[model samples]
Target: MVHETAAPASELVLEPFELSDDFYQRPHDAYDLLRARGAAHFVRFPDGGTGWLVTDYEAAKAVFLDPAVSKALKSPGAQAALGGDAGGAAMFGDMMLFYDPPEHTRLRALVNRAFSGRAVRELAPRITELADGLLAGLAEDAATEQDLLDRYAFPLPMLVICELLGVPNEDRDSFRAWSTTLVSNDETPEARGAAVSQFLGYIDGLIRAKQEAPADDLLSELISASEDGDRLSHRELISMVFLLLIAGFETTVNLISNAVAILLTDNGVRAALAADPGRMADFVEEALRFESPAGEGTFRYTTAPVTVGGIEIPAGQRVLVSMAAADRDPSRFDDPHRVDLDRADKNHLAFGYGVHRCVGAPLARMEGGVALTRLLAAYPDLVLATDTELSWRKSLIVRGLTALPVRLRP
Candidate 1:
């Protein structure tokens, strides 16, 4: 039987989170208010779900380590709180993000083999080549001052992930639209469901094709495992592929875009990276902390009563760890707002912590480093286009710029 709990009297309630408008422009300001109030603030999320938002670094880490916390989708009150037909679970529920040990452990182990460091290392050269190819197109559009997100940042990761999953490049545009809608806070649940259905159907077809004629790709390897050991069901296979493909490049798109914006705006960082191009990795780390690409970690619900930052949260309630806010916790990071490439402690929760940490982190880091290094080398005088206005993506989970117009030459 499913167990649940009632809310305690000490629960701190606040207004619904403002993900659009002001919050999109300056999310830190809102995060600052929440952090100042306490380590954790109970807020009605944009989806109308009331949950605890952990803002401080220590608190965030504690929540990650707490055994009482769970990734199970059957949270007692979460569905009603989120209103009818919550679409997030349909997309992310069957994946690793919403599973616990034994199930999570089994799935992680199988996928981990394909994402091993050696595999990522082998792909680095191809990623660098891909970046150069994308840069060539950007150079062609130099005179027009194109949007960086559209011209390079968005397509590069999308292409790489498509190639990695052995999916046809021709279908890129369709999945790109699907990805945008899935993570978008602006889309309605019904709309999001349509996108999910289409994406899963496509993936289902891809998996079946791989099963019949195995190839030298990750999908083939997974299909092999499924056929050999009956280790995976159809839903698990589709969900795993979905998680990898979406989580694989979506965050990297934002990371690379954020790096370009940061490097151009801050000459000091640009000069530092220019002097020692090897520090491109460090630059990516700082960007992860300073302006986290993934604004927040996936949701976790408490199986038992737990206290975070002295606020008592009862069992069965949802919890959200703000990775963006935690990375900038003044207590953990010095000059938290500043982007410093030389900082000794580059530890950031951008990829998350513990068991639920991103499986594609190594690929993300390599992609960011290669993209930054090549982008800077290709366009020595790259700077944001003053004529165009910059806009941030209106998303609570993923934080990034919608458009970053830039000139190729100084």
Candidate 2:
């Protein structure tokens, strides 16, 4: 039988565990603690359940690719252990990430066209234009202190995804709000539930619209996909769109914001990138390794008893792979904590590994490369607006900045 409990934050005693304040706020410190401990360790959740937190790099890659640990539809217990609530169950039940192969493989194949290499290249011109437009607006207001995240980082990704998915321009505001609440752990359960409901309702209408009058958007393509006459069900299509919106936009937002935060704080790194725009890709890669947006890997539940990093995790136990910790593992990276844009063989688990690797990774890389490159090119003297206190989202699953205030030099 599965066990659950709620103990004092201090009693958890895991080096990688978050302090109460940090748990609800910034989690980099917690991940650092975990890295200090070792590869894998036991963690006590807020609900009192004991779960394995994998901090080692190679071990995390192993778990991510292990078919023995299934993401099948029946793993509701595993979902809950990953901090998912009832609404998450409803919306994520049919997503590609929640299923093990051959179902996972089949679904991923059908949608791969959207993110395929050729498709991403086709979208490049559009992405560049969008980035330029956003920067134009920022430039006008660059005279005073600005929240780079609010003015640029946040809207850029949302607009790009909305354009890609064919979400009506006017409806993006509501969609953005709904998507934010659904991924937020700070909100009450009821609030999240309501957000999910609203999101589903909106998506349902969009799917119907696509059915009646299909467009060339990703949603239309997903709505019409057929594999040997097998296609996504209505519910599956809705869930897929929901997943794309959250995964595509949220991750990029954090990545751009996090890269900016890191660049501003580290003058040496910032100067190197500013000096050589060609080196932006390396800078982005190191940023991803140094501080990943997804704080931890998606939750995985063991379908059969398995030993990971010498720890015996029994069947049905929830396992969390700390992407932040794994990326910083000393075994895989020398001087892992330091930001080295020139670091070679920088194969960090930032996009995860194996079957459940982020589908939108290519797109995210393209977006980050373009955004950072342009931001540096446009605002050569950008600096933090103030030495303001930075706040993180409450959700452990995602590491993101709540607000990033900065000033663009004239």
Clashes of each: 0, 3
User: Residue by residue across 1-410, what tens digits does model 1's lDDT show?
Assistant: 10112455443143334343566677788787778768987765555456788999999999998878887664443443344433376566678777878678888877776565343557889898999998887766776667888888888999888888789989989988998998887888798889989999999999999888877777776665532354767788899998888888889999999888888788999888878888887888999898899997567777788899987887767788999999999989998989988789988999998888888888898888888888888888887887544678777789899888888875
Which candidate leads the pack in lDDT?
Answer: 1
Task: For residues 1-410, write the lDDT of model 2, one tens digit per residue.
Answer: 11223566665434224234445464555556665655666776443445777888888888887776776645755644454443255567788878888888888877785555343457778888998888988876787888898888988898888988889778878877886786676677798878888888888898899899978778887877776777888988888898898898888999999999999999999888768888888988898988898887466778777778776676666788888888888888999889998899678888888888888998899899899888888888988877667777766667788889888874
Candidate 1, superposed: residue stretches over 4 Å from native: 1-20, 46-48, 75-92, 117-119, 226-230, 387-389
- TM-score for predicted model 2 compared with the true structure: 0.90
- Residue pair clashes in candidate 2: 5-48, 16-34, 385-406
